[model samples]
Target: MASDQPRIDFSGGAVGYRFRRSGERGHPLVRAAGIKRDHMPSIVDATAGLGRDAFLLASAGAMVTLIERSTEVHALLKDALARAAMESPELAEVVGRMTLVHGDARYLLPELKPDVVIVDPMHPPRRNTALVKKEMRQLSSIVGADEDAAELMRIALATARERVVLKWPLRAAPLLEAPKPSHQYAGKTVRYEVFVTALKPHVK
Candidate 1:
């Protein structure tokens, strides 16, 4: 491992602190994924790198399956989740709601048949690198760029029973190759672009 490689430590340090502070409340993602008391969606996080988003969703009561294609990242996430789960009662409960799969989502989406799919392909490197976090930069080197992100979105749109939520850089242009999002939830840095599937009306 290199000095620049970001350690996947979910139970301690910054990640743990953030997850602890965020708690199990509904953030923008809860709304983006349409999580409600009557509607706890089964979500497949297709590009679950560090799985921060998946952890957040699981904490919010959704059953989340995190799919990480990179072998190294998958291993890191697996260890981190296990370590985090043993840290406390609350974390254990949240980790119980998450499932990690080591595979490419393109091949696994149809088989999983989730109600919602989250495609957060790493965004292209920003021109102004000053704003990019050191951890993010290190993670980028591990995963590289998501060149097939457009295709991933198309497949997710076709597979999800309800919707596909795309986490993207708010300032960047939307994926032209993918269909227009049915809705958008904008945060300070990133946004969740939702594409409602044609499968049927979302369950209330």
Candidate 2:
């Protein structure tokens, strides 16, 4: 478990915390999903990690469910959520809309049918930008890489009703080789691949 990950708070609330890449703003893939403020889906971030991407999704208007397997990570995530709730009352309202489950996303995701499921398997950082955010660096040193990334991807694709999105390096291959993405969003180092699972039939 990532026991050494740094945790911070503001006024007895989870205001700001540190992650491997603390200074980074958001997940490139998640941002690329093109989620509209009003068309928010119920999202489950299977690999919650330090909850950075999950937090970003929530901030984007999706009701997020974060599933974490590491006990240490689970604890820190709760603390951060609580602190975030306390610091920003508005965030607290958002927290009310979110849920954190301290368990494997594989087991939990099946029971919760979200409109969209997001997974970001931990991959080894390229030697070039291996230098991650301080908080992420610490946590990564402890949590290591996700051994079941492929499996998680499979599960997410099956579980999501509308779509399953995978966040990967811009140069990496698709998580699953089935149904090529109907759309994609590219960033400097990463991108979001949107695989549309079902389509509404045309109305007569």
Point to the candidate with the largest lDDT.
1
Q: What residue runs in model 1 are displaced by over 4 Å at the alpha carbon? A: 13-15, 18-24, 127-132, 201-204
Off by over 4 Å in 2: 1-3, 6-31, 127-133, 199-204
All candidates: TM-score: 0.89, 0.79
How high is the CA lDDT of each candidate model?
0.85, 0.70
Report the number of the highest-TM-score candidate.
Answer: 1
lDDT of 2 by residue, 1-204 (tens): 334565533223232332223322354554555466457678888888767677766655678898988887778788888877876675676577668998898888889988888877775554444335566567676677788888887787777877878778888766667767778777777677877764467622
* lDDT of each residue in 1-204, candidate 1, tens digit only: 657666676677655776778754657777999898788989999999878889889978889999998888898899889998888998899899999999999999989989999999988665544524666787788889889998888889879988999999888988855468888998777899989884545642
* C-alpha lDDT of candidate 1 relative to the true structure: 0.85
